[model samples]
Target: MNRHISPDGYRVDGPAGQDDETGADLPAIVGRNLRRLRTRQGHSLDRLAKLSGVSRAMLGQIETGKSAPTISLLWKVATALGVPFASLLTVEKQAGTVVLRRDRSKVLASSEGRFTSRALFPFDSERQVEFYELRVAPFHREDAHAHAPGTRENLIVAKGAIEILVGQHAPVELTEGDAILFEADVPHGYRNSSHGEAVLYLVMTYVETVG
Candidate 1:
């Protein structure tokens, strides 16, 4: 294995800065799930690589949380494992499509404080829709992140402000109560321009199931 170290703020062992019972543990939870699925299918690292066309080294890295897999790679693994790509993602359950209370949410924060995510669905939900509350502190910016082929990210501003930059489109600014929905295939990033903190809600979908 390459034995790559966890990025400064990111946790390679699991979701960073989250505890076992606090819902902050998505990375770990997801990692375990992947391991379980792999074991259940009687596939080894080499077998997964041959089946998914992903390198065994890469699979080891993903399974160990030493790296973040690109959306395409994730899909390949999911396909080989015979599971929905969304099944590998971590999300908390919501009461409905309207709101997600803080108390019932799981917060995923990077150790470096770059970003924080609160799940809107149970971490193990099989639903097609996934909701996340994202917080980007001042001076914190995100690299382009994308999901499965048909995924869409609905960004709604609940507090503070942020600039949503998607692929080649001009950046869009969202403030409190403002929201934007777009295809998540192309690269995207979030920038917090406020002097203090900025928060937003991101609802990601594997298909166009939610309008």
Candidate 2:
């Protein structure tokens, strides 16, 4: 793999066999990268562990590759690191760069059949904005969720109807083709109040400070 630096100087390593390794080696790689990035951002392990709601021990294990993380674990770590979950893994090498078909895109289903979110890009950049396709079943409501500092969300309704509540504002109704952009810090919730399912496209942007 040819390791290069992004414009921001963060390392970007993509090549075959990066995500494949025998035994605990994978975690070690992930841990190393996580620690390096965390340090670069001036975040102590304790602070990161606290912010991510993950145990320091578990994070250590992930950094050391002693424990392979589940999807939820990955989610926590990625959220803590302020990166995308897939950013932790190395991409497989391919000749001629064959692309994976849309059917092969990884899918994340909501625990309750209420909705589904599909990631649109790899989540590895130190300061990356994420894009997702959200599907909300009829009459579904999501518990309030908040993002980190400076995180912002832009949601566009593609089909059906959606009701969004941000902070103290009254729930706003959105029909197909309508869009709203807002800061994500305040508690927020979403509901599909229409008779049919609703489809929404969401963009999540992360803000980072560099000295």
Candidate 3:
């Protein structure tokens, strides 16, 4: 299979040449959502670039479906647009019971692919809480920027050992079955301390729904 690395350094991997479950191109979906939201808020590319700290060229590329955005970049744009992170990924809602199969999960990885996050909930509607599965390569660390105000995260270590660092607070270590809850409005990071990959589950709750 051929793989292409995004400008932000993460690679996109999925069934070759296949669309996502929504039967639409993933990049196109993101692009449409971005363009719609940006125009809706009466913000031009230059204005969005200033607010998001992302270059206008890159923003234009994303809006035109010419480039796939990285997780960090998406977060920056979402924050700037005052919308939920999932808002950029959402498609038409599917009614009734929904089952998210593992093979079909939407996964986002870090630049080096040492860290990954898989969304466990459908991205069809605005939600106050979101669930995700996270994996960190052995001895790898993933740093995340601050989220919107009033955000909170509850995470539990599922396998192996790792350390959680939240802002200036001392690092908190966790083993299998250990969990921690903390405000997520500040910078935070995860460090895997074991020789084997570490697995974790995260529940992120927002203070209010946006977009």
Candidate 4:
């Protein structure tokens, strides 16, 4: 699929002429969720923009499905809305046992496709913890802003080598089979300086369950 750059300078995955696993347009899902949450909280575009540090025009575009959002932008909006990051991407939950097929997993990529995060668990419910599979292109560094207070990330490198930098702390290097856990309320980043791509599994836990 071709990537469409949003006005905010983030790359958005274009529609592939087919529905996602939820049988709904991805952008529309985000837009509907965003609008619902915003209105439910009695927030206007101007108000949300101030709370999220995003532009009012951009917020309007996203809410109207005229533009797709980046992971970082979504995080900011979700934080402002006091909800889980996955809440914006949530779809109808299936009853009984569920299996998330790899082919249909929801993937969000960074600008230039240098970084990608695939949700490993269903986004059907609001939970305190969420799981994801992260990939970093060789020699690429993906930085992330601070998350909500009391949030933490437990990550394990599945392949290749990488460095994790959190706030003012020293960079922690890890190779295959290595793991680390850190507070995520400070700015952090992942650097894959090795020749091969880096793969990691992350489990993000918040202090309390959020919608």
Candidate 5:
């Protein structure tokens, strides 16, 4: 953990990662990835829409680059796909140098630009876990759908305050230097309850598929 983060201090907001070798736009990249993954899994728009809790129209929009999905929506899609959350957000391989870099990492942001997650490692079939630097804007909440069974999420608060709610349990509060780990197989979210942005290190573990 070299802590490679956004260069712009705290307000790192954007959509679906950085430019790969191709320099494609965020919508195009996400749409292409989503379409490929859905078809590979042999899921149709109607079926995937029902499974993901997103409307078939919206799914069609996302698959056609006509819309940009929020973090929550993307999470739903990934969960339905039985893959890591970054599967649809990632369009290109991260350039390697043994250590991660801000430029090399793929950063995915909410459609509203309130939440951003920067992937700290390259995704591959052999990897069972994914790590990220998460940034949440003031008063923003990113609600994520449940992951595949046996998935867990670990969060370490680096700055500001956050309220985390997993499943239907009570919301847990965390401040600077505090960490919380919980089963991510249920619905979960991160909320910035304070006026400042909440920065955290998030680790996602998957079993048999991604842990």
Candidate 6:
């Protein structure tokens, strides 16, 4: 399977669970997550260095699991990826009947790593409602694909500021403790242009009840 690596920071690896990151494989987990996020965003080590403000050499070392970064350094990289610092630390796991902690949740990132989305619901293919939390870095915009017919999305700003744009309408600006709901069948997006990070809890609901 594609770990999404290129010449700048590429590596092919086994699929999740085959050789996925676990609690014991912290460094490898971080490296794998970083590589996947970087490649999906089309970032080479050089480009990631520019984005994360970390040296390319260090970025390479992190990818190869040869180096462990300080918490501050990890923050820089997480900010660059528009994801929470905990995301890089999360371990890959199979979906379970119960998830006891957010820190242990599985994470998915934007193509550019400008946004990190944590799944809050069980990985049920038939589930109609999907819940998630999103972390976005300053000045980052995330485009979301349209969902099923009659689908709707609801969001609450847990922290910072954001602008939600649905279809051709003007963007709606929100601050801490604000909320919005809109049809998700059409195109939509979230934008965070402030100097501070934005945190949002999102709920996506489809028309039909999933079984």
For this target, which candidate reaches the highest TM-score against the unseen true structure? Answer: 3
Please give the CA lDDT of all the candidate structures: 0.66, 0.66, 0.86, 0.84, 0.75, 0.69
Cα deviation of 54, candidate 2, in Å: 2.4
The segments of candidate 5 whose C-alpha lies over 4 angstroms from its true place after superposition are 1-22, 94-107, 110-114, 122-127, 137-142, 193-196, 208-211
Local distance difference test, candidate 5: 0.75
Single out the weakest 10-residue window by summed lDDT for candidate 6.
6-15
Name the regions of candidate 2 deviating beyond 4 angstroms. 1-33, 39-44, 64-100, 123-127, 209-211
Arrange candidates, best TM-score first: 3, 4, 5, 2, 1, 6
**Superposed Cα deviation of residue 82, candidate 3 (Å):** 1.9
TM-score of 3: 0.93
Candidate 1 displacement at residue 51 in angstroms = 9.2
Error of 4 at 115 (Å): 1.1
Candidate 4 per-residue lDDT over residues 107-158, each given as its tens digit: 7777467898888887776678899999999999999998878889999999
Please write out the lDDT profile of model 2 over residues 112-158, one tens digit for every residue.
Answer: 44666766654324335678888889998864456556778899999
Q: Which sections of candidate 6 miss by over 4 Å?
A: 1-97
Candidate 1: worst 10 consecutive residues by lDDT?
Answer: 1-10
- Residue 57, candidate 6: Cα error in Å is 37
Pairs that collide, model 5 = 17-107, 128-210, 128-211, 206-211
What's the TM-score of every candidate structure?
Answer: 0.65, 0.67, 0.93, 0.90, 0.73, 0.55
lDDT per residue (tens digit) for residues 1-211 in model 3 = 2244686677645444565555667777789999999999999999999999999999999889888888888888987887778888888888999898788777777748899898899888767788999999999999998887888999999999999999999999999999999998899999999999999999998886564
Better candidate by TM-score, 4 or 5: 4
Question: What TM-score does model 2 achieve against the real structure?
Answer: 0.67
Best by lDDT: 3
lDDT of 5 at 200: 95
Candidate 1 lDDT over 65-153, as tens digits, reads 66565444665776577565556664455455544355544444563657877666554455667777787998677855455467778
